[model samples]
Target: MHRRSFDRFNWQDVLREIPPSHIATRVSFFLAGFLMALWASLVPFVKSALGLDEGAFGAVLLSIGFGALVTMPLSGILIGRSGAKKVLAFAVPVASSLLVAAALVPAALPSTAAVVVILFCFGAFFGAIDVGMNIHSVVVEARSGRKLLSGFHALYSIGGVAGAGLMTLLQTAGLPGVGSACALSMLSAVVWLFAGRAMLPDAGRNAESDGHGGPKFVFPKGVVLFLGAVCFILFLVEGSILDWGALFLMDEKGAALEHAGMGFAIFSVAMTVMRFVGDRVIMSIGPKRTVVFGAAAAAFAFVLAVLSPNAWTAAAAFFLVGLGTANIVPIAFAATGEQKEMPMSLAMSAATTLGYAGLLTGPAAIGVLAEATSLSTAFLSEAVLLAAVAAAAALTSVFRKS
Candidate 1:
């Protein structure tokens, strides 16, 4: 059925006729971020309800990463064969359902194993959707002949803020975690139904000139690997902020529990604002200098954040970190879309896989390091990693031309 549709499709006609295609892509990015943030906001409640210790909770959390790792490589293949729209159609709904199941796990499931399975399934679907939407975005950006990837990512950041903020408010207003999760899941489904209508149909069908006849596997090689490493560091920094930034403020900077979240809020706001203008920055400085200066800024900010004596100063430093890291991933993804060594889908898959691995493991790695040394030392280590990322970005030829 998809092949028949693909055969009858005309790319030029579609571009001319479907004016909402770009809006649809943005909405898809928003929905993906919204769902993930909603899930994140409910994590504490879930952990409390399950009565799990830190170790058990950590183990359960690992399931999501494991599932994503298992599924991310296959996403490129699926998109190559089936197109991003079909994959998203299947993946989004599955992910939504799994989120609902996770919300109900406290009451419905008797064991941690069941919750882990549900989270694993949720991660699998979520990972697939992540890659699919990105593949779709790359196609859309290419068709538009401009730099719009940063704006698309900015919407994701906005969605994350909105989703988590709204859910936190609702829960604070006395809604149960299960009810909040269900409501958000339904909202996401509705958005998907509408937005899926306007998505470019079979966007990934032409990924290869021969039409899905490319190699089965595409491991990162050469500049792609270097790009992936840069992505890994940036993503690890991002994940560290999400998971540990607040704890760092509270533990090391003498921030109250209520005020601890301010660090991430400052970081997030800075990131979102920077991303809104990132295309212009890239246009002015190009991706190479953008990455080089961005990494250096973030590393310096990390140093300042670590040395800060109070929460306010730390928040200020975090804001700088956010500004620095905001555009690196978008720039990298744009580079990935243009590279000629492999199919875009494969390159994107490899990069997303490695980057996500960093996001998944960064928090735990920091925790382990902190136990052995201190949080300050762990963060200093991150600053050193960012410096390495800067050096690597300076040396890589991929961004030099862009």
Candidate 2:
């Protein structure tokens, strides 16, 4: 948990202690990224297999979101009371199973109803895993007292890149739909099992029994709520990039099919690079200033992205947006953990759930609005959201002394 322990542990000690914990984080991140990719990759296959039109496909996608919404709050409670390791231990297998089942169902039954059911289960499992892994990351980062958190998150993004790229690659290579999905599922399951042993010991029972008195349920106080709102807005921007960036290029900018992914790819690469550099940035600038400046920069980036004429300018804008958003969520998580109004675990759960809602719903909300008006209008609206974050940052004086 500490830098000193890194060298002091014998090979066996390292294997028994550090390796599992580190591996857990890595596997969790990899699987999360893979799950996101599986959706994009399997969409065409799902459409074909289920004999669904775009409207029907949209309805199926809505089922996934609803399942996530249903499960996230419950998953938070489990992680709060039982600790991340236990929850994740269960979640990983369930999620992997769902992925495999979802892959199989289309071929076996090949119906819209079956795909919807499978996707709902997949969404629930993914939500649980998301919260559990993040809880673990927070605990580890706290013990180390350094800026490892952002780098840890970087791994999740790296996994996303790998997942999306691999899906595209396999599809191009002519892998069958079921085969590709099964391959990812098996890979994720193997990685998760191998990493399970290294998880940080669950302190939930110990904390509760020791009479420090954990909260009865998860909820955020005023400041935590403010921070949560900030997280929500920031993540909404990220969700937009992930889901809509390609569409924006293709539909509005006339980008070719092959080039559509470039917008998101640029955003992903820029975000990854910024996170690797985030530790020193936070240390030097401090969290408060970092959030303030980061929000401001991101707002500016969104404006540039919306206003830009050429695809090249838009791509560069996305990169800037990624750079601006790189550390804001990590900083918010750190702040949430430091808040004193409630049990850390409960408060964190609340913050995470609300923030994740932004990631889950924001894209669709944008899409709905875009349908009523224009995609550019939707993007400009997100720029407004970032500007709202900037105002909140100023009010929090997240840069001023706490």
Candidate 3:
């Protein structure tokens, strides 16, 4: 009996028993966020060093989004063929190195065209890694039979904060842009090397075989489309907080220049904390109610922030917005993973692409609205959209089941 029991445990069983996939997924998410944040922190320096004007800089920035759009759909196919772990091992380092390359360009080459090309490539690799990591997260969550996506996303948020803070400290301590990028690149390499080994092998193998072995791209439709639409709204709200929250506080609420960032800071902190506890929230309340109530709360908070007379009240409202929007994306992704209409990889890829489109478009939309009407009006428009998201969430059967 003892021999038979010992014989039952195979290598796959061992791998399952010592499941490091979840930890590795979290690390990968963190690394991706860190690399992106580090690049963002160095953007001003890069622009100055390259001597690009606002128009030229904006054009360069658009290249990154263009590249991401080009590659995001293809990533699902790639992950389906090669698996998330293999794709990530190749993509993450390439993306990080490209970031270092972009930083070095301003110092050595200093060409706008070169910077654009490098950044485009960086965005391509980054987008691929993003899809790969999320696919991996789904696999891990499936195996664990628990809610882990929220916590994984929380690590990404934490990584963003840490990366931005550390890069700022390094620059303030007299490090050049290239030097800072180099340090971050090295750190990224170390983290990936350690974590890459533990990632689940062949993570999307079943997904690939689930009628997704085709040459064409699979776009989100049906329930996947609904979930993606919800994600789009949530991502738009998040982007608004990042890009316009500070401006809203400073311009509308009379916040000092030094205090301008407090709104976003509070939002980020609240969001991070809520995401850390989001799994429990989802388990207790279910995804449907969580998303519906969360969207309502976010819409109400946004209106409150827009109407608040003082900076402190606006910051409080922003904090509420954070808590309200924290888990919507995770829930959406979780639903995508379980949807029967398409392969998880393709569904998630399409959903992520739509969500990213909303994020990229949001600030520009707000700017247009603000220019035509007022910033307050622009925010009110977003609140209305959030309300629509809430309604959709309440009606969607996918959210009901997930």
Cα lDDT of candidate 2 equals 0.77
Off by more than 4 A, model 2: 1-20, 167-175, 203-206, 209-216, 250-260, 368-373, 397-402
- TM-score of each predicted structure versus truth: 0.89, 0.87, 0.91
Off by over 4 Å in 3: 1-18, 172-174, 206-215
The whole-model lDDT of each prediction reads: 0.86, 0.77, 0.86
Off by over 4 Å in 1: 1-18, 169-176, 206-213
lDDT digits (tens) for residues 291-312 of candidate 2: 7788788888878977788777
Clashing pairs in 3: none
Over 1-402, each residue of candidate 3 has an lDDT whose tens digit, in order, gives 999988886988666765688779989989988988988887897899888898889888998887887898888887777678888888888888888888887879888888999999988988898888988898898788888888999999888988988887887999775688777887797789889988988875444354346545776789888888887888888888888988999999999999999988899899999999999999999989988898899899989998899999999999999999999998888888888888777888898888888889988899899999998899999899989989977776778756
**Winner on TM-score (1 vs 2):** 1
